[model samples]
Target: MSYEVTGKLVAKYDTVQRTETFKTREFVIEKSDDIGGRIINNYVKFQCVQDKTALPDKFNIGDDIKVSFNLKGTKWSKDGRENYITNLDAWRLEAAGSLAQTAINNAPDNFVPDAAPDDVVDDLPF
Candidate 1:
């Protein structure tokens, strides 16, 4: 099955040639959220293989990106022992929230002049 996730790109590694015909590249994304006034962070890594290894080259680190990937699993047996591995195989990448950030960045600056003295507290509903 395929899944999608949006997060800030944290780290990207160079493409590695596993074998003569098999090559892969991996990258990490950081997903953070606020819960109960505390910030939680999650780092997820994904792999791109073959021609897709270059998928992340266009985007720089720290860019918010939406990754579309497929969940892949493999079973390996060696010395009568069996092991399984799971990989998030990313196929496509697109810049996330650039338009919104650009719009907010392009807006005119709003300056608020402080006209009241210190300790003057307004009544605000809590």
Candidate 2:
């Protein structure tokens, strides 16, 4: 499955050449949320593989962006020990402002119009 996240770009790391034909680049983003009147910040890391490794080059630090990625997990066994790893493989990215505008543009065209002004009245009993 795929998931999307929006946050401010915090860091971009150099691409790693794992082998003759494999490469990967990693980047981090910071997301803040308010919970119980307190603010919490989360630093999330995502990776782009092969051709997508250049994905982060178009954006600068502190730029707000939306990333679309796939959740990947791998299990390995060595020396009678088991280990699991997880990765967010990013495939698509765009500026947060453009993302919001795209959502508005894609809204349904059959939206209902507001009631006529003549039909509106102060009918509240309060």
Candidate 3:
């Protein structure tokens, strides 16, 4: 399965040549969310393998991007010990914008809101 997230590009790492035919690059993105009146920031790392390693080069640091990636997990056993690892394998990227922004941008220039109903009162105490 594939998933996507929108965040600001934070860091990009050099590509690593694992072997004669294998190469991989990693990049990090920062996502912010508001919870309980506090802002929380998370840094997520993603990997691009082989030809996809150059994906990060298209965008500069601080750029807002939407990344589509696959969640990959591997399990290894060595010396009677078991270990598991997870990776976000990025495959696609694009500029980030909210759905509302897209809608407003696509709306016609002559568009206008309808008038409020007569029975509806605007009185409210805040």
Candidate 4:
């Protein structure tokens, strides 16, 4: 199952190895304003497979983001201690905006090149 969530980017950490077999990244995103009440003071850490290509190049601490992910949980036995964990495996991420396109257009004009630099000064390849 999948769901959408919007929160503040509280932390971004380097990738970590899980069980040496599954590698993942951990990042803390705090719930600021959502259906969940009084979550602003509580932060939730999500573990996901690091996909550098999918992350925003300009994301920084305190930035707000909207993510789409799947809620996952795990349970394991640990010498009589019950080990349980839960996290959201984010599959999609984007700057928080009223609409997706608005974030793109509102970004710095040079945020990403639409055409080659030569095309800007020389002949149109069209």
Candidate 5:
């Protein structure tokens, strides 16, 4: 299943790949105000693919962003102990600007779902 997260752009960097095809950025999102603004205080990072047309040019540090990402799962095992990890693989990063950050949460048309798969039920059915 694909998920979208709205946050702020806290950092940005590009990975070297000949012509620099890989680029990733981190953002800070206010997950919830009710949690005393703790969740939103964390630095959540998102990634942008090689496509230059994926996002607008307004994306900058300290700007509010709404990121759409894919949920990627990972596993770790060490010293007879195993653990699972998951990360948000960002596919699209949108900067909503500071003025629009508050309005984005309530904006009904902010989320746009194109052609996507349905029923992403895992075979393990966790």
Candidate 6:
């Protein structure tokens, strides 16, 4: 399964040659959420491997971006010790809000959205 996240690009790293035939790149994004009356920020790091290593090239730091990724976990034994690693493998990345804005911008000038009138009654009670 895949998941998507939208946040501000915080940091990007150079592509790394993990193996003779394998390469990977990593980047970080800042995600903030409101909890109670305080705000919490989370810095999430994601990895792109192989052909996807260059995925972050077109985007600059501090840009609002949406990332589509898959959750990956691996287990291995090294020197009689069990080791586990988890990676957020990002496959698709794009501007967070540009896609939706582009659709609205491409709409014909004469196009008018169907919405409630100014005097629409509010019938719902709290």
Q: Of the candidates shown, which would achieve the greatest TM-score relative to the real structure?
A: 6
RMSD of each: 14.3, 11.2, 11.9, 7.1, 10.8, 10.1
**Which pairs clash (backbone N, Cα, C closer than 3 Å) in model 2?**
none
lDDT of each: 0.89, 0.90, 0.88, 0.71, 0.59, 0.89
lDDT of 4 at 50: 51
Which stretches in model 4 have alpha-carbon errors above 4 Å? 19-21, 34-40, 50-58, 98-102, 106-126
Q: What shift in Å separates residue 51 of candidate 5 from its native position after superposition?
A: 4.0
Q: Which stretches of candidate 5 lie over 4 Å from their true place?
A: 16-32, 36-40, 49-58, 76-85, 97-126
- Model 1 deviation from the true structure expressed as Cα RMSD, one decimal place: 14.3
lDDT-superior candidate, 2 or 3: 2
lDDT of 3 by residue, 1-126 (tens): 999999999999999999999999999999999999999999999999999999999888998888999999999999999999999999987766654366558879755423368755566886
Identify the candidate with maximal lDDT. 2
What would the TM-scores of all predictions be? 0.76, 0.76, 0.76, 0.63, 0.50, 0.77
lDDT of 1 by residue, 84-120 (tens): 9999999998777884366467766752233366745
**What is the TM-score (0 to 1) of candidate 5?**
0.50
Clashing pairs in 5: 30-40
lDDT of 6 by residue, 44-85 (tens): 999999999999998888888889999999999989999999
Compose the digit string of candidate 4's lDDT tens values, residues 4-114. 887888988777666666677767778865455543466877666856323633577877888778898899998899998887887777777444466777789656535
What local lDDT score does residue 105 receive in model 6, on the 0 to 100 scale? Answer: 89
Query: 32-62 in candidate 5: lDDT tens per residue?
Result: 3447655535556555545643353556666
Candidate 2 ranges beyond 4 A from true positions:
98-126
Clashing pairs in 4: none
Candidate no. 4 TM-score: 0.63
Q: TM-score ranking from best to worst?
A: 6, 2, 3, 1, 4, 5
